[model samples]
Target: MRCLLPLLLLLVAASVAKAADFAARFDDLVRTATPRQLYALLYDLPKGGDLHNHAGGSDRPEWMFEILTDPARNGGDAFYTRARFGPETEPAARYRLIRRRTYEQLAPAARAGYVPLADLSPAERIAWANAFRLDAPGEGRDEFFNVIWPRRGDLSQNLDARLELLVVNLQAFAAEGLAYLETQFGLDGLVTPDGRALTPAEAAPLIERRLAQPDVVATGVVVRFQDTVIRFRPDAEARLSEIYAFVAAHRDRWVGINMAGIESDPRGRPLRFLSTLRRLRAQHPTLSLSFHAGEMDGADSHVRDTLLLGASRLGHAVNLIKDPDTLLLLQQQQRVLVEINLISNRLLGYVPDLTQHPFPEYLRTGVPVCLNTDDRGMWDSNLTDEYFTAVTTYRLSWPEVVQLGRNSLARAFVQPEVKAKLLAAYETRIAAFEQKYGAGSPTISDALGKVEKVKPVTYGYAKRTWGLEFR
Candidate 1:
């Protein structure tokens, strides 16, 4: 026993030494690596899952153009952009995509104001992309909330377009080594190119069939949907009840319910849905809730009230620092996981200075926090951008980064069996990454060669910010 004890002690000491050496090496890389190199490393990192994605918001404008312009994939459908010229009465240049009859079908009077998206000249195409993304300097919250969404026109009203978007998002996430994705989507007004509305019940099967396609299946990225109710809408309660029923019926593909909207509006207060959610629980007791709370600039009790709303996951929780009790509940008890969207918060003008973000506070205090792409396409970013922001801004340790992935899978609303499989797979993948990138091992560049490096859409923004250009 004594002999075994001495040997065990030696093994323990060696393990500790190895860990310390890896830490030193990681810290050195963090300090010395160029933004490009660091971005490459992050791109190859195993991000377990994205739990707070919005399907429509993740649509890249370039990709959208490709999807909308291709005749074979409903691209031949006529779409128009609401263009504002100089001397317009709006705050900024605003454009929205509208479904209008074809050039041949429309009367000359009706066709006078609309321009076909397919026939847009190069300059017009650039203008359309700019209008869709939050890529402009002065464009921020209002543009995102008001202009960008409406610009999609009837695009969101088409399930096939949505399926294509989901496929692209999944493919992108898979390329970045994401094991799962929980994106918010609703089939409320989904229609065909000919304007045939499909009910949620009908849309669910089509979505499942599309997801089961060979290409999507080959990616091996598990995906589920959360029906999002626009909280500030007048019929939010009625919409909530309908989504709850839809989610209950489509539990295979739909897992949770999320209320997302401009929270600063008084109508979006957490307490407003308290009784409604309680009643919803009485009927559909198993429904999971991931509430967007505390996304405000000022300190308020919204976070506390959201907890009262019984959300298993809190999206944003930006103002949690102001409420000590709620912070303790989340941190000390680890009662719920906070979905942190660093890029979204910054780009949306909620937390402009990332250093002031409560992500590190929540993480270090033992609150289960995971990185997510809240509106990656809108931000012209993705999961890697979120990690980059968190790691660079907060100087996260390697273990902390790994724990973020673990927390993402841990808090996901996937089935228990699927979650277990995902968690196990994530552990293996991360271990391989650590092993490959450990001290005295190959450099990040060498390790990167073995993995796929997806060129991120936000690279331009990162380059401008870091003063580093890509080849």
Candidate 2:
């Protein structure tokens, strides 16, 4: 018994040592590296698609501020101001879409101290726009998603504006190395102008008119289901039917539907969403079906119930982690993809940070997880930024990032052939990138000044799934 206790102690100590080694390595990489070096390790990497999106925040915040303040455009927001919270910590301040400054300084101004999810203040908004301090961890996720709830419905509708907004956002994402996106659009179904519902045909004109723009279409737009908020209306089902039928007709533009919003709508049921999806799938089996599942720590019943709702993609899906059997069923089924947003989760207070996140367990167990930025504007993030948070914080290597990228492409709403083609292109990029710039993660160690691994050499990344040796 005494010998066994020493053996156990040694094992535990060794485990702790390994963890400390990884953390020290991470700190070295972050601290000693320049943004440019960090960007290279980050730049031109072909991310598959952004499965999770909030139309308002998915793009750059300056774009939103630009629209709000542009003399050429029109929205109802008023003048900006600030309340004195602290010298360095003014929770309120005026922000403007000033064109003269560097592109990073733009932000929107407003009346009162509206502390929305991202801290609705000029200073905070400006900081977020610049990607300054954007990588820090910890906050409330339920509030993160729901806090912006008041604005999403109002901000999403302007097709022309959003189309323009998305083009700029796409260019920015591309600059950071993303090539594809399963970008969600059109949540206007919840509110209709003049109280007249958007008939399927009307929705087509609403969308096609925007997609007609070359810049808009160049971004690779995929419409998530379009619906107005129906939590209060009598015609929730009818409206959904309209949206589904519209997708059936224009399957190419409208890719899928996600039942976003707080769970537990008396109407937010699998039968309703499934009935709509099942009907839509009959015509467009190719159409994707994703949902914001028990982002809530909802009732156990809600988690399982949402899974059965026939969703192809599950965004957030934090609570579902609580039900292991259901998690297994999802893994076995394989069609379901999770939009795991580490920053979003921490910001929304799901877990303290990536260290506490369930991603390692979920990914190791075979449940397909796709990293995403749920609300870029609010979270003050981009898809690649979210990817970075996943890596160093979670201790994922170059190989896993490759797997994550492939997982995203596979789980994307695009056709199978498109995914194949995209992966092929990535192979070409990796080959060229490898010859010029080294392929490994740069980690400094106690024994060595700087060590970098050539990813292709070490982790056999392929056009599809990661190399078997890794598993």
Candidate 3:
């Protein structure tokens, strides 16, 4: 027994030594590589999943333009935007963007103020596209929360466009080496081409049919969904009940329920739905709950209240650090995960400076945490940017990067067998990555050559933040 114990100890020591070697190599790469090369390396790195994504909010404006302009893909839907506001424009109709269906129903004078999306001049098109994202200086949460969603207008009613966007997102994530995606894909406001509201049951089959297509299957991205409820609405409780039941009925593809909306609103407080959630949990015990908690500007017990409502995951737990008891609970239990959205928080002014973010604290202190692109399109960024931000800002070690990826999958609301497969794949891929980049491997320049061939798609955020331009 003593002889076996010595051998086991030797193995453990060797493993630790190898991990330390890889960490040193990763630090060297970060120190020596240019911003572009480092970005490419992280872009090529294997990632587990995106668990806090909003399907609609993740659609890039370029993708939206392509889908909207293509008649065949968009189900012949026409879109319009207000090019000029006049006295005839109603207070609500003064939004910058609108759909053709909504434009048609507007007063003639108000309709005259709008132009077809395709008819916009080049400059107008650029301006229109820019409106969907936080591209300009001084743009923050008010612009994002007040205008961006409303600008989506009636596009949310088009199931075809939404499904196509999903496939596009899958392809994009697949290219970035992500293997799983758990997006919040709500079908609450879907309407038929002729303007009839469809039930979630009716809309779900369309989504199922679209996902079954060969194009979607080719991406090799395992996709699951969470039905979302806008918690600030007056009817949010009823909506949550309906969504919970819908999610329970659609466990095949739908795995959980998420409450989203501005967290600072008193109406959307975490405890508001406690009784409803408890009643729902009594009958539907298996459904997972991941709520938007601790996203406020000030300290509060929303994180604790969200836990009280039986949430196993918390989105944007920015203020979580303020609640010492809850933070300690999370650290000791290590059961629930905090979905950290660095770009979203920064863009929304929740954390103006990421260096002050509590993510590093949460991670180093044994709290389970994972990086996510909460709304990539709005930020004009991707998963790679999130990793790049963490590595550069926090100086993450090799094992820390691997653990972040693992945490995302481990805490995902996916089936056990699927999660197991994903975890195994991630382990294998990350091991290969370490071996390829660690000491005594290829030259850094040669490694960069291989990385440059990846051709990661960059946007305003990458260009503005990192001066990275990808062709």
lDDT against the true structure, each candidate = 0.80, 0.55, 0.88
CA lDDT, candidate 1, residue 295: 90
Q: What is candidate 3's local distance difference test score?
A: 0.88
RMSD, candidate 2, Å: 13.0
Q: Runs in model 1 with CA error above 4 Å?
A: 1-21, 83-86, 89-94, 100-107, 439-458, 468-471
lDDT, candidate 1, 1-471, per-residue tens: 987998989976875566566666567667766677677678888899899999999988888877776655653465665453445535332445666443356576645655667777888888878777788787789889887876676788767767887888898889778999999988888666676778888888888888889999999999999999999888999999899988998898899999999999998888999898899899875888998988999999998898898898999999999888878877777879999998888888999889999899889989999999988788877788788888899999977888899999999999999999999898778766667677426675554443335454344456555654445
Off by over 4 Å in 3: 1-19, 86-96, 439-446
- Model 3 lDDT per residue over 1-471, tens place: 987999989977875677777887788788888898899889889998899999989999889888877778887787777767768755334536566677779999767888887888889778778878988899988888887877788888888888899899999999898999999999877876678888899988888899999999999999999999999999999999999899999899999999999988898988899999889988885799999999988999999999999999999999999999999999999999999999999999999999999999999999999999999998999999999999999999888998999999999999899999999898788877777777446576666666667777777899999899787
Reference-based lDDT, residue 362, model 2: 77
TM-score of each model, in listed order? 0.91, 0.67, 0.94
Residue 213, candidate 2: C-alpha displacement in angstroms: 4.1
lDDT for position 160 in model 1? 71
Winner of 1 and 2 under TM-score: 1
Worst ten-residue run, lDDT, model 3?
Answer: 89-98
Question: Of the candidates shown, which would achieve the greatest lDDT relative to the real structure?
Answer: 3
- For model 2, give the 10-residue run with minimal summed lDDT: 456-465
lDDT of 2 by residue, 1-471 (tens): 987999989976864454444445444554555433343354345676677776655655567656534434422222222322346532213232212121123343322233332234666765534431223333244334433343333344444456567667776666555656666665453224223444446656766665567765565433333232242246656666666666657666666766665554555654555565566557654545676766654445555665666667787778777877788887787767788877666666666545867787778778898788777766655665666566556667555666787787677776567668777676565444433333233424321222222121111111111121211
lDDT comparison, 1 vs 3, better candidate = 3
